[model samples]
Target: MTQLQKQRILVVDDEQAMRELLTDLFEDAGYEVSTAADSFSMNRALEEKPCALVILDLRLKGEDGLMLARELRKDSSIPIMMLTGKGDETDRILGLELAADDYLMKPFNNRELLARVRAMLRRTTELSLPQIRKEDSYSHQRYSFDHWVLDLTSRELFGPDGAVESLTYAEFGLLEVFVQSPNRALSRDQLLELSRGIEADVFDRTIDVLILRLRRKIEPNPKQPRYIRTERGLGYIFTAAVTQC
Candidate 1:
């Protein structure tokens, strides 16, 4: 790929050896690679370089990577993957909650890492492609649904009373599915594939967690979600009529 077309990757790890290894790997993959040894340096790199992807290690002296990931998600949608050796279910899930796109345990295969990098980049293609047709009922009139107000021209979600809501890249995808299907019952597999962009062999819990989060903001009563409903074994249902003015 030409220099202009190469993906820009930022490697954030305090270990010098690990940083060199990742920088080499990404450069071999025809990417523009940059490195940071800590959060301060990482932020400095981000300010100076236009990074398309970030490979972040979860541990560092004086700062935690999970904390770094949260701060990054607050402003940019740059894809993030967490590298960690800690093996705990709760920690993995919490990393996901903080908006890391994926995680790999230490001693990960290079091939697997490459595959994930490609998948995350491939999702960029959908942003350029034409959106699929939505149900006729989906509209953006004078109203509020969930925590968002409608942005008519852009058709993006806004905060209630007209402020812009800070939605992560994945959260926007989930909202897109609901807007398109409104009032339809979609299975966990369907939600995972349709919204999260995972191809196959997806664990159902991912969709469940996403739904739980979306409900907290969108539903009138999160405990008894009006926009999203559980259909027992059947899956989930979104019940909203989006209308435009």
Candidate 2:
């Protein structure tokens, strides 16, 4: 019998000992592990093969891992677990603020690290699954709202002029939650759970950022959003009528 292929994980740290440690640790747990010492090598590894998650060190030789995390967010929704040193709470907070999936301090227990990795991988898989429509028989499905159409299958958005507007994975996930729960005021906590499936580490700013990005694409006037509206002290709500077909 052929052995099952393992999910690939990229570990980026400038320390050779830490890199070797994680490579051995994850590989022992049946993961195909890869290591990079810095952003350049990390990018090259990502370009060469798909990685399910990245374990990055907050302090690199000359590069800021936080900035690298931000760049990764712009292009991919791959789960990121930041590794921080002692007394680095400020950078940890900034990492969460920048929308990292989770974080772990240096000298973390191997058991806890393994658990977090499994949990994050599960959430990533959940978010990547295509939502099931009521009528599964329909092949090309779309959700229409306020002159904008979201193709559920392709996960693409179309403007009133019928031009396709590109959407990142995070933007699409948050929009899917809002559209499905139209006219309901969803709090940051609720949005986190509904959108990402991992709520413990989620921050309010992350949800706010996703909402702003979605409004730019779906709202006629993003400055005065007609679709997604803020509820002051409450949260946000989708006001337009959403029709799925």
Candidate 3:
């Protein structure tokens, strides 16, 4: 790729060897790479230069990578791919709920990592493109449901009182899928494919966690979620009536 076309990626890991490995891996894949050993350096790197994606390690030296991911999500919509240990399933699930876009278990294949990074970058680029097909209901449209307004063009959500609600990149994508197909039952596999174009494997549970998080944000009562409801053996459904403008 030409320099103008090369995307930038930030790899945040405490270990030097791991950081170097990832930096080399992504750089060889034709991306501009930056490395940060901790939150301080990570913040500095982000402030100094913007990156297309952030690959965050779940375990950082004396710092909680989950907290860093949450902080990043709160401030920016930048895509985050978490690197996690094999036994950190709870942490991995929590990371997703906190809106990390994707996660890869430790000892992951380098090719798989590159593929995921490409997929994520492609998704983000597609969302930000100025020109989209007008006939595509999911693109450049505003969807209203249960007093909330979702503006796909601006990628923002407005509450009933007209306050802007903060949604991470992953949350927004999943919510968009639901609003576009309101009142339809979507299984975990379908939701995964529709939202992120990933298959349902270990990520089926991740879908459930994301649903729980979305309910907490949009449903008046997450405990008895009126907007998104479970469909018994059929996964979940968006029960709210959505109108598009």
TM-score of each model, paired residue for residue: 0.80, 0.75, 0.90
lDDT of 1: 0.74
lDDT of prediction 2: 0.80
lDDT of 2 at 124: 63
RMSD of 2: 4.1
lDDT of 2 by residue, 1-245 (tens): 11345788999999999999999998888888889999999999999999999999988999999999989988876888899785555666677657576778888888878877887776566545655542453775678887888876666678889997766555667788887899999998888888766634445576776777677767778999999999999999889999987
Which candidate model has the greater TM-score, 1 or 2?
Answer: 1
Q: Which stretches of candidate 3 lie over 4 Å from their true place?
A: 131-139, 199-202
- After superposition on all C-alphas, the RMSD of every candidate to the true structure, in Å, is 4.8, 4.1, 3.0
What is the full ranking by lDDT, best candidate first?
Answer: 3, 2, 1
lDDT of 3 by residue, 44-117 (tens): 99999889999999899899999999999888889999997766678778988886888998888888889989
Against the reference, the lDDT scores of all candidates come to 0.74, 0.80, 0.86
The TM-score-based order of candidates, best leading, equals: 3, 1, 2
| TM-score for predicted model 2 compared with the true structure | 0.75
How many Å off is the CA of 236 in candidate 2?
A: 1.4
Candidate 1 lDDT over residue span 129-197, tens digit each: 323322333542333455456443243467656666655556667777777677788888888788766
Candidate achieving higher TM-score, 1 or 3: 3
Worst 10 residues of 1 by lDDT: 128-137
